[model samples]
Target: MHQYVFSGLRVSSEFKFTIADCEPFDGSPDVTIRFVQYLEKPLHPIFADEIVTAAPNDVWFCASGDLAYRVKDGSEILIQRGENVPDADVNLYLVGTGFGVLCLQRDLIPFHCSAVEYNGHAVAFSGESGVGKSTLAAALSQLGYGHVCDDVCIANSAQTPMRVQPMPKGLKLWDDAAAQLNIAQGARVSADLDFHKSYVNVDRADQTGGLMFNRIYILDNDIAPEFSIHELKGAEKHAELRRAIYREEWLHFLQEPRKTFDLVSTLASKVAVFAFKRPDDLSRIKESAKFLALHFDDGDAE
Candidate 1:
């Protein structure tokens, strides 16, 4: 059996993983991932089909021709690998998206963000799909920022600084972004045969539990000629947090609205949130990274 501690949970799995940082859990794992030949259909009606069907207690997800996964009671995963996908492909979705669902069902705050640990705290970039959250995280890592996590960010919001977990899969980059950035990233790990998503390795930097979250930037896709930052407050900040939840469609069924509100408000009260309006030009992506590096530089944070 293969085992690792991920996102603050002790996870034991039946398959090897290509994650950046994986260590054996001294204690018994909180989540157990078993590999099986097949899974029976849910007894109850599925919440939805095609993508994910989430019941009050269980969540089931499938990839077109690779694997099918069922997440149960926020504590266990049943993965059925199809003949079509390689082992790495099966593990790709299992750890990335599948585990994110586990966090949501467990009532932990999971955000669609890529975070980097810098100086003494975590800095995260959240944005719409195709807006380069992973790209920015990659840039930061190349610049010597310790990687915290990617794609799906898990947080222990109950803490004062909202401790961020290291998902530790490194940066998943598309072909275009990889070409544009010019960083000598490791070999690409295929996410799906049908889709071109790829992952590049970032060497491990973890704190066992997590790192303190200091600031989050929502990379607004709103069209603009120039880049700008808008600091958000009160309701706006909470709204952004709500919107940032990875695969938020599961939230309606898995959690109460009031609990989510309190979680968002508490985090907002502690960490800073900003809406960063990025311009339409793709060439300027590096410029945006430079802006962040300079802005968060030692003297500038204060």
Candidate 2:
């Protein structure tokens, strides 16, 4: 079994993972992942769609082709691997949507963001898909910033200072971005033969202990030629943060509004939220990263 620490939980898996930075652990795992030859979907699902079928405390995620998964009770996962699917592709969904629901079941908030270490703490960037969260983080890394986590920032808001569990899986980027930035590609991440998506290794922060998460920047597109930053306040900030929840459609199946709201409210109150707007041009990513790096150094947001 592969043993490692992920999102503050001990994980033992039957499959090898390509994504690195998960520190190995020897203790009994909090979550166990088993590979099965065949697994069935939930009998009576509260939610069903082309991608997923969900029941209370149980969810079946369907990836492309024959790849499917069953996440249960926040403690175990049974994977039905596709015969021809690459392990890297299977791990993509396993660490993305599958672990997202697992975090919710474990009462942890999985904020959909790409984070970098700033001033000894975590500053996360969040936004809709294709908003360049990963690319911007990669850009900032080129400016000497350290990558903290990607895709999901596992947050424990119940704590006094809102700690984040580090789960850095390198930087996943599109082929165009990788080639444009001259980033070294690691592995092919597509299952359905879309070869554009792949992983790129970069400098990372130390994940020895917990890190306090204090800032979040919601990325927005701007028609202007320069970058801009605006602070969000009151209900707008709260609403924007709510929309950052990963796999939010599965919230209905989790069904813990009071708990969820409490967590969200605590996060909004603890972390500073801002609207960061930049041009959509990829060639200007370094300029945008320099703008953000100066902002971090100046401590302008704080």
Candidate 3:
């Protein structure tokens, strides 16, 4: 068995993951992954589609890539891979959408954002796909900011000050972004062979514990020439945070409307949210990072 720490949860899995490995612990794992030949579907499923059949704590997900999984009680995952499916394909689902569902079952909120350490606080960049969240984060890392996580920002919403757990993952960038940042020549691992995305190492932050998640920037590509930051207030804050929920489609299966609302409300109240707008130009990404650094400096001065 291999031990790994993911989003602050100590996991024991039958198969090794690309995540940061940890020494084996004495106690039972917070989460476990087991390989199984077959999995029985939930007898009483609350939500059933062609691909997913989910109950309260039992979910059977069948991916388009011919992979299947049964995640139970937010503590265990049973994988049933299709014929000749590679470990990489299985891992892609396990870490992304599967983990998002697990977070909901554990009462944790998963924000689909790129998080980094800036001025000793976890700052998250969230927006729609292809909106350059990871690109901006990679640029910030070039300027000495620590990369916390690339894709998912998992938060412990049970606490007063929501803590963002470090995923401790390499920055995954497309081929263009990698070349643009001039890190293409570095020793990197291919994240996805088909997508031409590669995982390049960055100056990672401390991965032992969670950081106080403070700020969230919703990246927006605007017609403006220069970068602009607009503070979001009241309903705007709440709305932006709600829209950033990772795999929000699965939230309906794990029905907890009041809990979800409370979590988002508390997050909006504690953290500052802003609309970070810039021109849709990848060449000026370094300038964007500089602008953000100066913004943090201005905040420190105030």
Give all TM-scores, in the order shown.
0.90, 0.93, 0.92
Q: Please tell me which model should have the higher TM-score, number 1 or number 3.
A: 3
Q: Give a tens-digit lDDT track for model 2, residues 80-170.
A: 9878888877888888888898988888889899998876788899998888999999989888888998899898878878778866566
Cα TM-score of candidate 2: 0.93
**Predicted candidate 3 versus true structure: per-residue lDDT over 3-113, tens digit per residue:** 977787889998787656666777889999998887777779999988899988889898655578888889998888777777666777788777888877887888899
Ranking by lDDT: 2, 3, 1
Span of ten consecutive residues with least summed lDDT in model 2: 18-27
Q: What C-alpha lDDT, on a 0 to 100 scale, does residue 190 get in candidate 2?
A: 71
Collision pairs in model 1:
none
Q: Candidate 1: which stretches are off by over 4 Å?
A: 20-22, 191-194, 202-208, 298-302
Taking the tens digit of each residue's C-alpha lDDT, what string does model 1 give over 54-74?
A: 777687888655588988888
lDDT of each: 0.76, 0.83, 0.80
**Candidate 3 clashing pairs?**
none
Q: Highest TM-score, which number?
A: 2
Best by lDDT: 2
